[model samples]
Target: MNMKEANKKAVEIILKGQPTLVGIGKALDVIPGMKEDIFLHAGPPITWERMSGPLKGAIIGGLIYEGKATNQAEAEKIAESNGIKFAPCHHHDTVGPMAGVVTPSMPVFIMENKTFGNKSYCTLNEGLGKVLRYGAFSDEVIDRLKWMEKTLAPVLKEGLKIYGGEMNIKNLIAQALLMGDEGHNRNKGGTSLFIREIAPSLIRSSFDRESVAKVIEFIHSNDHFFLNLTMPAAKCIIQAAEGIKGCSILTTMARNGTDFGIRVSSMPDKWFVGKAQDVDGLYFPGYSLKDANPDIGDSVITETAGFGGFAMAAAPAIVQFVGGTPKDAIRMTLEMYEICEGENDTFKIPALNFKGSPTGIDLAKIIETGILPSINTGIAHKDPGIGQVGAGLVKPPRNCFEEAFEEFVNSMEKELSNE
Candidate 1:
């Protein structure tokens, strides 16, 4: 097919996706190709030596959680010794936020794109602050992970089984946009909706009332709890567009602490990479910009699917965390439309008069318009074990998109040569 026809098919496949929160299961069981020795992280792949501090810290935490190491020093030693393997979550049809580390023993949510029959995985969210995803490898972090594996995962799994129906994630996202959540950075509405859908099954489950209450209370308390769910949900939606010949829209945008990378539909296996950029936004008291690490996370997948930052106009209240005025949020959404292939009919924005979110990021348009996708993310501290210090907006370095544009031109040239 011509590029235009391919892009049209890609956009339709992506927008037609219906991701559902199927259930939860152990990482080794639910995640495709997961193994006891492999450590899956958030962004494009990197090795131990090249990994950032937070990424390193999360590995340490993952090691302890997996019983691969007894303490931080042991974890570090094994990591440097190459006693374990490392890979990106995206490579396994999974996605993670921030430090995005997943060990064999952790619990993960299974998301299925019913329309396309593809599945994606992501670990449950550990509410913000000193969480493993942010690279905090302290005792508290390990303990919290253990609790999630032992309690939260099982509760949710049973609840989903009892509920026995697909949790229509696309509809939830649509409703969330109307309720002022952009499906990343700010997910209060989505989390609330998730709870509403599952609370009944959770209550009816055989688990003790106390455990049920704790799970419900825990989810209720953490607004970002839904971030993990949305990450894989977005991945499930976007992956439907992968491998369409001549399609130029992006299917992946992610960051390992060390690099920012993107994959386009036409070149699904190749990652165009650049230096990860630093974030600019408000910081917690006593933590200045100096404490912030460069942008990190698979959460940007939300933006790739066309909501997160691309739908900022629908979540103006998000400015409270990402440091922008309401007008800036609207403008960000407007600017995004110029670089995207189309609007997401299901993920509509109320502020834009119920217009769909800018979807299917077109690499050609980004280079042509000189616009980078805007991502609002939590800021990890520069040092290992420091966790999150702030929240803010960031842009992947321009060089990545430039590289993607080069790939696009070369692809066209190759096709013409063949013709």
Candidate 2:
């Protein structure tokens, strides 16, 4: 098929994909291809030697969590010793936010694409600051991680089971848009909606009253509770559109704090990478731009599925946190339309008068328009243990899109020649 036909086919699959939250489980048991000693990270692949501070910090945290080390120094030595294996979460049908480290025992949300019978996985969101995702691994961080695995994961698993079949994630995301959640950095609406849906089963669950209350409190307290759900949902949607030959639709956009990467539907496994850029926005009182780590996270999956940054018009209030005006949010959404192939029929933006959010990023459009996809992201601190310093907007490196477009052209030319 020609590029046009290929793109049409890709968009068709993307729009029709249905991702539902199936259950929660350990990474090794739930995520496909997850194995002992293998940790899935964010963005393109990189070794321990080349990893950035936050990435290294996360690996050190993972080592501690896995019982391989008792202290940060030992963890660092273990990582450098080649005893650990690092791979991108995308390679294992898993996605993680920020540092995006998924060790064997970490609990993950499993999403199933009911439309295509495919599954995707993402680790649970650990609130915001002092979390492993941002490369912080203090005693508090390790304790929180343990609590999530022991108490939170089991309760969610039981709650999901008691709730019966898979929960429709797309529906939650659509309703969330109306309630002012773009399904990424701002998921307060989505988190509330999720609690509303699961409260009934959680209340009646066999777990004791205190346990139920703790689980509910945890869910209610963390506004980003919906982010993990959204990531896997986006993964399922984009995975459905994978392998459409000659399609220029971008299926993946992620960062590991050091490098940013993108993958097109036609070249599903090949990553077009560029240096991860620092975010430009608001920072905490004690932190400045100098203290911030570069943009990081698999949360970009939300934009890949046509919401998040693309649906910013629906969440104008987000500007207060991310350092922008309401008009800037709307303008960003409007600008995104130029680089996308179509509007997502399912994920509508209420602020835009029920118009579908721009969906299916097309490399050709980006190259032609010279506009990069804007991302709403959390900024980790550059040093380990400092955690989140800020939240802001960032754009994928231009060279990433340019290189993807060039690769697409080469692939198309090769296909034509074979014909």
Candidate 3:
């Protein structure tokens, strides 16, 4: 098939994907290829020597959580000594936000692409502030992690079972867009929709009233609770489009706080990387642009699946948190259309007159339009343990897309020569 035919086939596969929240389980139990000493991180793979501050901090936290080290010093020693293995979550059919660290014992949300039978995994969101995902490994962070593993995971697991089976994540995301969530940095609507679906099951389960209430309260208090759910859902959607030979569709976009990376459908496992860019937007008090780390997270998976930044037009209020005018948000969504191959049929945006959000990012179009994919992301503190400093907009470096396009052209030329 020609490149254009291959691209159309890739887009068709992505559009037909149906991502569902199948269940929740421990990372070791649910994620394929997870091992006791293996720690999965965000973005493309990098070594301890080259890891950015936030990524390093997260690794230390993971070591402590896994009981491989007793303290930060010991954790650092283990990390530096090669006692632990580091791999990107993407390498293992998983994704994590920010530092995106996942240890064996951590609870992960499980999503399955009903159309393709592929499953994706992502850890539960830690509910903001001083969490390990942002490079914070304080006692509070550790305690919260423990509570999630011991308390939250079980409750949610039971709740899913009680509700009969997998929840359709794509449907929730569709309703969320109408309710004002773009399913990325702003997930208030999505969280509420999720709670609504699961609350009844929690109440009917064997758990006591107080325990159920506590679980509901925890979810209610965290607006981004749906983020973890949506992330794996997005992964399932994008992975469904994978392995389309000769297609130039972008299947992944992620950051490791130090570098931004992209993977194309045609290229499969090959990662095209560029330096991570600093976010340009509002900051919390006492923080400035200098205090912010470069954009980081596996959350960009949401955009790769075609909602997050691409649905900015659907959630105008998101600009208040991410720093942009409503017009800018709409413009970003409209501009994305120039580079994407199609619109998502299931994940529609209400504000765009019920139009579908732009989907299927095309590398050739990106190079042609000179437009990088826009991302709305959380800004971590430059120093480990300082937590989130701000939220804002960033774009993957132009060089990454350009490089992928060049590789695509080379492969296509070789194919033609063989013909």
Q: Per-residue lDDT for 1-419 in model 3, tens only?
A: 87899888988888888989889989988799999889999999999998888888888888887778878899999999999899999999999999999999999999999999999999988888788999988888888898889888898999999998789998999899998889999899999999999999999988879878988999999999999988999999999888787898999999998889999998889999999998988898999999888989899999999999899999988898899999999899999999999988888877778889999999989898888899999889988777888899998888888888898899879987998
Pairs in steric clash, model 1: none
Cα deviation of 418, candidate 1, in Å? 0.9
Tell me the tens digit of each residue's lDDT in model 2 across 98-120.
99999999999999999999999
Pick the lDDT winner.
1
What C-alpha lDDT does candidate 2 achieve relative to the native structure?
0.90
Q: In angstroms, how far off is 63's CA in candidate 3?
A: 1.5
Worst 10 residues of 2 by lDDT: 344-353
Give per-residue CA lDDT, model 1, range 277-334, as digits (tens): 9998889999988888899999999999989989999998888788998999999999
**Candidate that beats the other on lDDT, 1 or 3, i.e. the better one:** 1
All models: lDDT?
0.91, 0.90, 0.90
Candidate 3 CA-lDDT value:
0.90
Give every collision pair in model 2.
98-297
Off by over 4 Å in 1: none
